[model samples]
Target chain A: MARLFKPRMLALAVLAALASRAHAEPAAAPARAEVLHWWTSGGESAAARTLADAFRAAGGTWIDTAVAGSEQARAVAVSRVAGGNPPTAALFNASRQFRDLVDQGQLTALDDVARQGGWDRVMPPAILDAVRVNGHVYAAPVDIHMTAWIWYSKAAFKKAGIAAEPRSVEELFQALDRLRAAGLIPLAHGGQPWQDSIVFRAVLASVGGRDLYLRVFRDRDPRAIESPEFRQVLLTFRRLHGYVDAGSPGRHWNDATGLLVAGRAGVQIMGDWVRAEFSAARQRAGVDYGCLPGLGEHAPYVIQADAFVFPKNRDAATARTQALLATTVTSPAVQVSFSSRKGSLPVRSDVELPSPDPCVALAAALMRDRARQLPNDEMFLTPDQAGAMADVLTAYWNRDMPVETVQKKVVAALRDDL
Target chain B: MRATWAARAALVPVALTALLGYLGSTLWTAQMSVTASRTLPSDHFVGMAQYVRLFSNERWLLSLDNLLLYGVLFISACLLAGSVLAILVDREIAARGWLRQIFLYPYAMSFIATGAVWQWILNPTDGIQAVGRALGFSAFRFDWIVDPDRVLLTIVIATAWQASGFVMAILLAGLSGVDPDLWRAARIDGIPTWRVYTSIVLPQLGYAFATALVLLLTGVVKLYDAVVAMTQGGPGTASEVPTKFIMDHLYGRANLGLASAGAIVLLVTVLALLAPFLYARTRAAASIA
Candidate 1:
């Protein structure tokens, strides 16, 4: 009982200290920051270390709190903020994910840091717009992750007798068919709902093209969803279902990546972060494996970013640390190093690639073209709408649901946005 | 077992905990179900909209069906296997103590570790089927782990493997208390052993079976960990249960309104199913008294 009571007393003491700090007098305290994020993977951990190291160099003490999954991490962060023990910084995707939190005045905007770093000019429009909610920067953008990259095993491609990267959707399917004929698993896919949504979005961008894809996702246009083009995309997505093995269902994305890693499967449509897996397996990009960002020239570069948001904290010392940490993380030195390890492009366009991987270099070049910049579904859809849309895609993937029904459901899912 | 002042005082903490933790949250959930809450609770009430949306959802519907299939199959299989194991040990079988310990061993382990191991063993491509082929039994197949139509049964198998031993332990205690004279009289009458056990011993084990049944039922309703560890309610929502659906909405989708609504519906269902059983139990007790 004494042992138990001791921990409870200590917890209460900490809570009391935090409570008093919420109304603490302005004092010149040492810079200390508590950062909460969902970046527990090996590559992500190293990326976090870069930021931590940078903050330490910038005269701040960095405290790291990493949760394994985004949903759980965000929940913990939000609860902490609500419970009056908000961390100095919490990581959120550069999307409408934090819109309500900002509305409730729970976030500290980093407009000063944004101006100091010239974020307006360097950041891509999609990411810039995401962080700059209501003309104030609510998050410090770290890295840009492209969502529509098609990764392939070079060995599998060789066995399939493929000569070069397919430049068009038709050619891409032809390559998949060749891989299928070679008696290898053509598409190594995890059948989780999110994974299903990834495949669907990849198909939407590659097969449906830029305008159709943007209209359905960004505009939530009902007519666009009902269009023949969207129908074709849906059909194409359903057709790829036949390419995966029986073990694809309920499999993790990393396990699916392992199929490519082992040369047992040909291709996987996933984010740029797959580079970490290749790196771990000692498979050099453009040699052991290859990446195609999209179908062709007409395809837009789909951008998803991870950013840090400061929780509402009035303590002078904590606010100072938050500012220091935000500025340090977005600085070119930190962004370049962090993004490289994180398998994402630096948020800053100014940073020159140092030891750039092949796929990342291609994505960076594509990201430079303003017209080709498109945000992922999360940026456009509320988390609710995105989840509903995922359900529609997953249902279609797992069942013999007709393409027409899927089209109607997709429109209904975006009805709130409409 | 007398209710004393110290015992009554002791009940204070448990009572307070139950009132605040269970009843308080349940009321809050009921209130939230009527609101248009996104990530957090809000006061703006939109009555029944969430409930309506929940029913309209294909994923929710599929989860309910999976839960029903899983519940019926999991409980029955556990009861059957548990009873069989108990009876086998009861007959003074060879290495009875060792066999009893082996049967109860799975109960001591956690579902998380067990489920993950089961996932690997049941994985079709490189797990059981691959092993079978390697051992020259290429015709052997157990791809139900990935099959959409049959995935819930795989959940049943994995959960039963963990839960059956628990049931066996309960039944064994009930078997021990059975009258020795009933067995001796049955032996004199030349009744078959299976008939004697079923007609005599099984009827007397009703109280024990009820206790086991109630526990197993609760397990079925709160079935989250096994599904999460084993299948994550996927292969595209094929194995999603109501708890997973509610959790996904409550956190992942940030639709607490829908999640609360789901909770309400699930609660009503459990009550509806339990009311008759509870009423019948009271009636039986009243008649005896």
Candidate 2:
């Protein structure tokens, strides 16, 4: 009995020592950050890892909590924040997606970081406006994705005998006609509502012009929506629906991109992310494929951005970690590495690309012209309003809704009361 | 008295769970429905405005219509197919266990898997239509999955295929419980087999049928996964259901008030439909007691 008691006493002493060590470890430990994002795809995960590696290199511990879909990730982040166990940082669209978080004071303002980093002069105005709310920088803009780009398979275009890229809305239709005549699918379109909205925005920006597009989306003026020019934009948008094959409905966007990759389809109106798909297929842009930022010379460049917002925390250590992440994300070097891997334009245009892809070069060139820059609909409208407008557009795209009726529906969808 | 007190004490945790876990959250949701809550729940009351908006919203209305259409078609088809399969298996065919396994297999798989398989099978380019065209039928057209008008039908086909097997399992258990003497009497009376099933056998399985109906009705109300997996309520929100709408509003759209309102309406609808059935079931139980 004395021998057993002696062993137990020694065990207790050891356990107490371990517990004390655990209690003392937090003070001198590195800044630990848990970042939640939705970059689960192959290329996306690689891009996300660059930021994580950079943060680790900056003397912080990076913990990745990747949820697959953006909506699911944001849902998890919002719930965690509301439940009072928020991550250090969470990814969100550089839009009105996180406005509620800001309004509720659930996010820590990164004003000091922004000031130190000179975010005001470096970040694009559209992205800056999105991340800055109530004169406080609440998010770090990582990359700018031009959402409305016309991606055409060079093989399909050659087969269709189209010589030059369409310079105007009329010429675009003529190219579609040629592609259709070649017996290939004229358009590789996914019939999802968001994809439909991408096509609609492309038409609105290229056909309706910048002023009309702003009036319709930004100003939400009913007069602009009811105008003849907007009607023509709607008509062009709907007419493109005819070029999509019957198999288009319920198809995933990646599958649509796969059609272009295999040269079974001519053109796909999608974001710059499609370049990643092309790259994965070993297709070189401007040789195997071509990306048109917009159809005409002066077409508006519709841009959306992915950003990271730091959730509010009272701990100074956690705040330091958040600041480290914000700075690392927007730093010129990390931005180039991340955006290059992700096939997106770096948020800071002041940074030169080491070796930009042709599509990125074009986007970079277009980015230099501030007047050509336009924010995507998500930037101008709330998520709910944007979803409502998407529903209207998708219904019109699938069904034969009259353009006049659709215009009224669009007006109603964008109402302030809604 | 001590035993009774112990029994009551044993029920305390369950009581607390029901009160707090279920009732508390439901009350919270109801409170949120009347407020102008967006991404977060706020106390700013709007007083039935969300319900008003929900009723007027075209997507919500269309979702309701789709749910009703899908529910009726799915429930009826499941019942009919299940009853027929049960009768077929009740005849004591050889390899009955294997037959039962084959029929019950789909029910064991998740709705997500079932929906995905059916999505591919119904796809126009490389699915059954393509197969048919390959087999010398050039004019074959089975593109309902992509057609806005017929997309919902594809969902019905996939989900009904998944659920009918479950109904069969339940009804088969009931079929086994029917007294052998009744079958002997039907056979002795020169009654046709089909008549025996429709008239005598089915009427006696009323309890089992009610149980299956309740389960299937609840499944219908919670019809989200299959729709999400197959059509994503797409081809232009053509196959959208109430549950999917509420989920989208709750998370993606960040309209908590509207989502809560939709949830409450869905709950009320389910309760209204099930109340009479439950009343009758309790009455029948009380009469037996």
Per DockQ, the best of the predicted structures is: 2
Scoring each candidate complex against the real one, what DockQ results?
0.43, 0.49
What digit string (tens of lDDT, one per residue) describes model 1 on residues B1-289? 5669879998999999999999999999999999988776778889889888989887888888888888899999999999998998899757778888998999899777898899899999779888998999979888988887888888999999999988999999999999999999999999999998788998899989998998898899989878887888767778888988888777667788989999999999888877877998999999999
Report the C-alpha lDDT of model 2 over A371-397, residue by residue, as the tens digit: 999998888888899989999999999
Q: How well does candidate 2 match the true structure in TM-score terms? A: 0.95
Q: lDDT per model, in order? A: 0.84, 0.87
Question: What does the i-RMS of model 1 come to?
Answer: 6.0
Model 2 CAPRI rating: acceptable
Report the C-alpha lDDT of model 1 over A1-418, residue by residue, as the tens digit.
0000011122333454454345333335568787878788777888899999999998887777765567667776776776777878888899888877887888988999999999988999889888887899999989988877899999999999999988887887898999999999999998888888888888888888789978998899999999999999999999989889988887777888899999999999988777888889999999999998888876776888898999877686777788898899999988888887888888999998796877777887887898887788888888889988988888789888878888999998887821
- Count the clashes in each prediction: 0, 0
CAPRI level of candidate 1: acceptable
* Reference-based TM-score of each model: 0.94, 0.95
Which 10-residue window in model 2 chain A sums to the lowest lDDT? A1-10
Query: Which pairs of residues clash in candidate 1, taking residues 3 or more apart in a chain or in different chains?
Result: none
